[model samples]
Target chain A: MNAAVLLINVMALAGILVAFMDDREKAILSIKIAFKGFMQILPVTLIILIVIALFLGFVSPENLSGFIGQQSGLGGILLIGVAGAIMHIPAILSFPLAASLLEKGISYTAVAALITTLTMIGTVTLPLEIRQLGKKFALLRNGISFVIAIVIALIVGVAMEATLWQ
Target chain B: MAISSQISNQQNLKDWISFGIVLLIAFVFLKIYPSKTGSVIEYFWQYTMEMVLILPAVMLIMGLFSVYVSNNMIEKYLGKYAGIKGMFLSFFLGSLPTGPLYVAFPIASHLLEKGARVSNVIIFLSAWACLKIPQELMEFQFLGWKFMFLRLFFTVILVIIMAKIIEYFFEITDDRL
Candidate 1:
């Protein structure tokens, strides 16, 4: 198996072993929870996978780069950054999706911005966040997160470009 | 609580509908471009295999974390205090395998009520949202070590800065309130 698969399997094995040693009932309960969580996310995962396939199969690297490649400039970065802030998906799944976008000639900076904001800002969860943490706190956290996500992405883009070019 | 549950239920419905639409589109794409369908299926299969390998383990880690690390326990530890220690603790606790970012909001609110610094609470919330261990591992798997570590480092630094900025703004707003 590849390292990623091996690592994940080992992690699952270790988690099960630890839980079993700690409490058999809770261990079993954890497994049930895992299964439920998987089921809940499966539909979304399939949809995203299908979309990614379409994205890769149809969209050419040049076309993608024209929108968000190395020279796509600040506007392109901002656009994807906003898209990331607004779109809510499970963060773990975002990496693969982002990688696919990168493979299609989207700039690394754009992908970074997308992943950062996608994880940090949750437009869908804003109501729950405001309800729990107060309006100002929720708004500030998300708004600031968006700006920082862009900044972080640009930095990564520049750094990566420098290294890759060298 | 009722509103959140209602929202989540709506979200679930929306997701199902979207999935249905996506499936329909996939079918159409296959029919229209029989030759391209091979590439689409290939990409789909690759991602599906990767996801099948990782997602279950990720979910199990999250499940074990939720069961073992009670929110009450987190509240007791991160509720109050200030300074570098509190900020670091917030980042550390937030990075643990607990639940999603929404769940962290309640914990953060509790911490605020218990007199935790706003900066620390922001740190905690952001860390919980972005820096969970299992999520990092998945990112590592897909994005490579350079991307993963660089993004992580940048996020940590920027999160702190953002927290401090928000804290300052809130303090000004607090006086007015």
Candidate 2:
């Protein structure tokens, strides 16, 4: 396997072993929690995977690039930023999807905005957040997050092009 | 608690329904474009393999931390540490393997009840939402270190600023918590 996979496996192995050594009961509970968490995310994972596959398979690079490509400009970034905030897919899967789009010539700014907003803002879960933390805090947090995501993406895109690509 | 459980149940039902709809769409697409099925399946398999290897381990780490590290522990750290130290500690604690943002909301409310600093609470909530360790690892694996690190650095800085601004606003407006 690749280094990422290898390192993760080792980390998990070490964590499991340590937990088992420390407390058998807790270790068992951890395993149960792991299983429960796995099941919880499974459907979403499958959905994201299939959707990504279809998206990449069908959407031609020209079409993909034309919309979010390097020259697609600010409107494209705004479109994606809104989409990211609204969509509630697990953030982990977003990286690969972002990478795929980047490879397809989508601007780094757009992808960065997508990832930042995807993680930072959750329109779908706003009700739960408001109920838990009050409307003011929830609205303020998410609203600020959306604005910052765009700023971060713009800065990142410029920095990457200047330093990394050069 | 009854209401919370009901909300979770409804959430679960929505998830399964969305899953079914996505699966149906995929099936329809496959049937319509038999020629592209191979490429679609190939992409699906590639992502599945990556996630199958990494996701469970990530979840296990999250579970271990969640089960072992109590809310009391979080409150103690975030409550005691003050100023810049407290802010850093809030970020650190929030970055640790934990549950989703919703899970952090209740914890944040509890911290507010215990009189945690508004800035620190905001940092805690923001970090819990985005800067999670496992989430970072996944980003690193897919998007490369440069992408991950740059985004992370920018996020940390902006989140701190945003938190402070929001806290100031809250202080001036309502003196809320």
Candidate 3:
């Protein structure tokens, strides 16, 4: 199993066992609080979660590694961001995709930028944004996102490069 | 929909026309800026595919909003709250919301009818598209925190600037639609 799943399952089992051990009322109360928190946020988050899930289902994380990540380092980094701008990986699948890519041969930098900026840098979504907002606003936001994504990716890349490349 | 818009079914005719023009501009741009890579198809595919999932959320959220947040409710909660509170309130609401960007427009129009300013609506819709926090969080978990932080920072700043620009244009044109 993936790290996320393993970690979540461990937490779930522990929480359930602990709750079962505690007074039923107290455990139920805590569960209620958790449910409330989820309700508060779920309205907004559910759709994004589903979309990300669907995206990962279709696109193999493995393909991403093959295309933009290989061993090119800096070039790969920029390419990933560029690819991300065009592609659209939801939040849910991004991790698994990243993990899978990294497992194969993607450098941390390229994967980082590609995954981060994928939604923000959308060439496809640009038309929609422009339709909703204006051209100038869309351009500014996208441009700034691209620049910021590059900087963040570089920082992550450098750190990973030092550790992994050597 | 305009007959031309329907017949042509080309919402972004300008995009196709200007795409070639933009190609030339890119040539000029490269001379000045010098980019490392030379293709955007992969990136295009990425965003397009992501939207595949987002589109349904758009329809669902649109229906939800239409039902839950009525015209009167928008006027009461969202009206006259235009400065920082308005900005943040709308920002949060927009981020949390899931639907097509247009879904918000009708509600905005209703609020405007009830007295919400265009600036507020523009900011709200813009933030809705950019400040999508739930999506961002999932992205962070999947992609990592680094990607999330940068996107949030840039999206916030971009929203602010775009909001102002939108406010300006609407002010000048008195365009409500």
Tens-digit lDDT track of model 3 for A1-166:
3443344335444654565586566555545544433333333233333333333433455666556654465666777788777764333335445654554566777766865576446576566556655665556556756776677677666665564534
Winner on lDDT between 2 and 3 is: 2
Worst 10 residues of 3 chain A by lDDT: A37-46
lDDT of 2 by residue, A59-125 (tens): 8888877788888788889899999999887777788788778767787799999999998898988
Worst 10-residue lDDT window, candidate 1 chain B: B1-10
- Place model 1 in a CAPRI quality band: medium
- Candidate 3, residues B41-136, lDDT tens digits: the string is 333345445433333333333333333445455456677687889877777666655433444545555665666665566557656554554345
Over A92-117, each residue of candidate 1 has an lDDT whose tens digit, in order, gives 77888998998887888999999999
Docking class of 3: incorrect
Q: Could you tell me which 10 consecutive residues in candidate 1 chain A have the lowest summed lDDT?
A: A157-166
DockQ of each: 0.74, 0.72, 0.06
How accurate is chain B of model 1, given as a TM-score from 0 to 1? 0.91
Candidate 1 backbone collisions, by pair: none
After superposing candidate 2 on the true structure, give the runs of residues whose Cα lies further than 4 Å from its correct spot: A163-166, B1-6
* Candidate numbers sorted by TM-score from highest down: 1, 2, 3
